[model samples]
Target chain A: MKPQRCVAEGLFEWPSDEPTVSGSRCDSCSFVTFPTQDACPRCGADATTPTQLARTGTLWTWTRQRFQPKNPPYIGTEPANEFQPYGVGFIELPEGRIEARIAGDIDQELRIGMPMELTVVPFATDADGTEVLTYAFRPIEG
Target chain B: MDDVAIIGVGLHPFGRFPGTSAIEMGAKAARLALTDAGITWKDVQFAFAGSYEVDNPDAVVNFLGLTGLPFTDVYNGCATAASALSQAANTIKLGEYDIGMAIGMDKHLPGAFAADPVQYGVPSWYGETGLFLTPKFFAMKIQRYMYDFDITPPTLARVAAKNYRNGARNPNAFRRQELSEEAILQSPMVNDPLTQYMFCSPNEGAAAVVLCRAEIAHQFTAAPIYLKASVVRTRRLGAFEVHSPWVPPERADSPTVDASRAAYEIAGLGPEDVDVVQLQDTDAGAEVIHMAENGFCKDGEQEALLSARGTEIGGSLPINTDGGLISNGEPIGASGLRQIHELVLQLRRAAGDRQVPGTPRVGYSQLYGAPGTAGVAIVST
Candidate 1:
C-alpha cells in the first residue's frame, strides 16, 4: 500500500486511523470557524484556541456539480473526458456550517437535514505518485 | 455636497464582438456618451475606468484624445462599475470636478468565470477539491433559499423566462431571444437547481456614463437623471457568499442588504418610491433572492410576486427592463454600468420598446460581486 498525504498541510489530520479537521474557537465570543483563523472573524478577538471540528453534521443545502471545473486548480488524476460530476454543499455541524465536497455516488439522492459524517477521501494523485487526500461529507449509515 | 446628475449614458451592445478589443469597445461607448452629453472628451475633467480582463483601462483615454486628465483604473470583481460610478459621483459631489466620467469594459472567455481562489485570499486546497465552483455556490444558496422560502423549480424558471422575454425587447441585449418557461426548465442543468439557460455567460461589452453637478445639469440635457445615492459594501462575518469556505451558524446580513439599506437612507426614499429597478441577476435564483434582499418584498414572497407579474414592465414594479445580465451577458466591469445605462434611459423615457408605462421618476440599480462585495445606486429624474 502507498502512503497518502493530506491535500492541505494543516487543514486536517492524516496518516492516522481517525482524521479530524482543525478549526479555531474564539475565547471571548465562543465563535468557531473552520481552517483556523488567526484572529476571530466575529468579534475580532485574538485570543483563540485550536479545536477539532465535529465529525458528523446535517446536510444544510446541496447541489450537483454537473460539469467539470476549470483546470490549474481542479487537478484530477483522471483525464478530462473521464471527469464525473459530484455533490457539493454546506453541512451544518454543531460548531459551524462548512462547505465541503459530498463524497458518494453522484446519482445518490441528497436531502436537506440528512445526517452526514466527515471523512477523508482521495482527490488526486500527484506526479510523484503521492495520493492527495481531502475531507468530504458522506451520509451516515445506521 | 452638491447633487450630481448623469448627463449622458452609452452602451456598446452587450455581446460577443469577435473582431473587437476591450479598448475599442470602451472607446465607442465613451464617444457615444460624450456625443449624447453634447460635450467633447476634452471637456471631461476626471475619469474612472473599471475592467477585469482588460490589462489597461486607463489606456482608453488615448482613443478619446488625452487632455492630461486624471484617469484611474479600478477592479472590484463583478462590482467594478459600481466602484467606478461611486467615485465619479463623489468627485462631482465634492465640487472637485464639474464634469466626470465612469466607464467599464471587458472581453471575457466563454463559460463560467475562471476565478483564481488564491488571488481572492481563499486556500488553494478549496479550489483543488472542486469546492471553489462559483455556479455551485449560487445553486446551493438558491437551494437553501428554496428550502426556507418554499420556492420551487418552476418559480426559478419563471424568473429566467421573464428576463429572457425582456431581453428580446432590448436591442443591446446579448441573449435577445425569448425563452419559454418550459424551454428554460428543460435546458441542461449546470448545477442542481440552476439550468444552463438560467446562468449568465461571460462575454465582451462596454458602458459609460457622464456625470455633472445637478445645478449645472441643464447645460447638457433638459431632463438630467439625478444621482440621489451611490453606495458600496462588503460582506461581514457569518454572511453566506460566494467563495466562503465556512460560515457561522448565526446568519448575518448580506452585502446586498447593507448596500441597499444605505442607498435608500441616503436617497431618503424606500422601495415604494422607486418606479424601476435593476437588481443583479447573475443567475435566475439571484434575482429572486435579491428582490427580497433589496427590500422590495418580504422574504419567501417571491413566488407570489413573480406569479402576480409584479416585476414585468407593465407591472407595479418593473425590474431589469433592459433584460439584465441574463439577457446581456456579464462583462464583469461593464455589467453594473450597463444597468445604470438602462435606468437612465428609462428615466428619460428613451427606452423605445422596453419603456415602462406611466413615466418612471425614480430608478434603482444594485450589483453583487464574488466573495462579498455589493454596490447600490438610486437615481431620479
Candidate 2:
C-alpha cells in the first residue's frame, strides 16, 4: 500500500500527534487564513508568514449535510449507495475560525461550542493509489 | 438630477417553459414592458439586461429589433435585476436618457445552485470536501441565529407556509399551489434545520421594467410609481455570506443593512411608511434574518410576527406578496424584477387577487446574493 498524504499540498500535515492546518498570518492586521493565501483578508497587507493553526478549537456553527452534493466539485470517493451524511462546521480557533468537516461523532451529537481537536481523515484516493487525507475536527472526549 | 420612475412593468410567467429560450423570454418581457408603457421598442433610448446563463444578454436586443441602441449586460448573482435597475435609473438620473429599460431573465436547471469554488475565490478542495454547498451555508447561519435568538424550528415552517400561500395566489408564480405548514416541516431534510420545502429551487423566468424621468412618467401611464431610490452595496469585512471559507469572530452586518439604510435615506422614508415589501426568501431563514437587517423588525421578533400573519397580504406589512423566490423559483437575474413587477401591480391596484388589502402607497424590494452583495429599490405613489 502506498503512503497517505494530505489532500492539498501545504494545507496540513500529520507528521506526529500534534496536527494543525497550515495558513498565513498577516503581520499588519494579525488576521489568519487557511490554505495559505498571499494577502490579508482583513487589512489587505501582503506581509504575512505561514503558520500552523490551533490544534484544538470550539465548534462555532454546524449542520448535517443530509444529501449528496453535486459532482465536479464534490470529489469524495464514497459509493453512491454507501454515502454517509456528515457534519460541516466552522471551528473557532484563537486566530479566527476555519470551516472543516466534523468527524468522529454522530450528527445528533454535534453541537455549538463543543470542544474539538484537529485530525486527519481519508477523503479519496489519488491516481497512483495514494490515500488522500483531509483535515477534519472530531469532538474532544471530555 | 432627474428623479426616476417606473412607467411600466411586465413578466414572463416564472414557471418552467421548456420550449422557450432565455433570450426569447427576455425579448418577450421587453416587448411586454414596451406595450405596458404605451410605447414601442423603437422608442427605447438605451437598455440593460441581466442574466446568468446567457453570457451575452445584449443578444436579447436581436429579438426585439436592430434599432442600434447601446445595450449593456449585467450579471450580479441574485441581485442582477436590482443592479440593472440601479444602472438604468442612474442613466436617466444623469440626464443621459429620458426613457430606458432594465430587464432580467434566466433558465436554471432544477436544483440547488452549484458553482466552482475558484469562481468564488475559494480553493477547489473546499467544494471537493462538499463544504461548498449553498444550502449548508444557510443552515449553519440560521442554526446559529436561531440558537442565539431563541427561535424554534416552527418559525421557519411559518415563513415557508406564508410565502407558499402568497405564491399560490399569484398567477405568474412558479409554485402556484399552497403548501401546508405541517407538510413543509415534515418534508425531507436537505440540510440541518432546513427541510426540502424550506428552500427555493433555481428555475426559469423573465421580468422587465421601463423607466423614465419622474416628470415624464405621467406621459406614459396615469398611475406611475416613482422610483424613490435604488442602491447596491457590497458586503463589508466580517459579514457572513455564501461561498465563504472562513468568517471573522467579530461579525459585521450583511450588505443588506447598508443598502437598506441608504435606500431609506434616499427615499426619505422609513419601514413604517412602507405599505408593502418584497424580500429575498432564498430560504425561509433569509427572509427572517433580512426582516431585522432591513430594519423591519428587531432580533428575535420573527416568531411572534410570523405567527400573527404579519407578513401576509392582508396583514400590517405584507412581504413577498408575489410569493418571493419561494414561489417564483429564482431565475437569478429576473428575481429582483419580479418583486418590482408585483410591487407595481400592488401599487397600481391592478393585482386582482393578490393585492394587499389597503391602497399601498409605498413599495420596497431588496435582493441579496452570493459574494455578499445587496441591492435595494423603493417605489411609491
Instruction: Tell me the lDDT of model 1 at A48.
Output: 88
Could you give candidate 1's per-residue lDDT for residues A1-142 as a string of tens digits?
Answer: 6667888888987755667788988999888889887788888889888899988889999999988888767877577788888899899988889999899999898999999988888878888888888998999876
Instruction: Evaluate every candidate with DockQ and list the scores.
Output: 0.78, 0.75
Query: What local lDDT does model 2 show for residue B81?
Result: 94
Q: What TM value does model 1 have?
A: 0.97
Q: All models: lDDT? A: 0.91, 0.88
lDDT of 2 at B14: 91
- Where does candidate 2 stray beyond 4 Å? A1-3, A77-79
Error of 1 at A109 (Å): 1.5
DockQ of the two-chain complex in candidate 2: 0.75
Per-residue lDDT tens digits of candidate 1, residues B264-346?
99999999999999999989999999999999999899999888888999999898998898999899989999999999999
Interface C-alpha RMSD per candidate, 1 decimal: 1.0, 1.2
Tens-place lDDT per residue, model 2, B1-381, is 339889989899998999999999998988898999999988999999999999987788789889999899999988899999999999998998899999999999887777898998998888888888888998988998998898788899889999999888888889988899999999998888999999998999999999998888878888888999999999888888888888766778899999999999999999989999999998998899989888898999988998898889999879998888888889998989999999999999898888888688999999998878899999998
Error of 1 at B192 (Å): 0.9
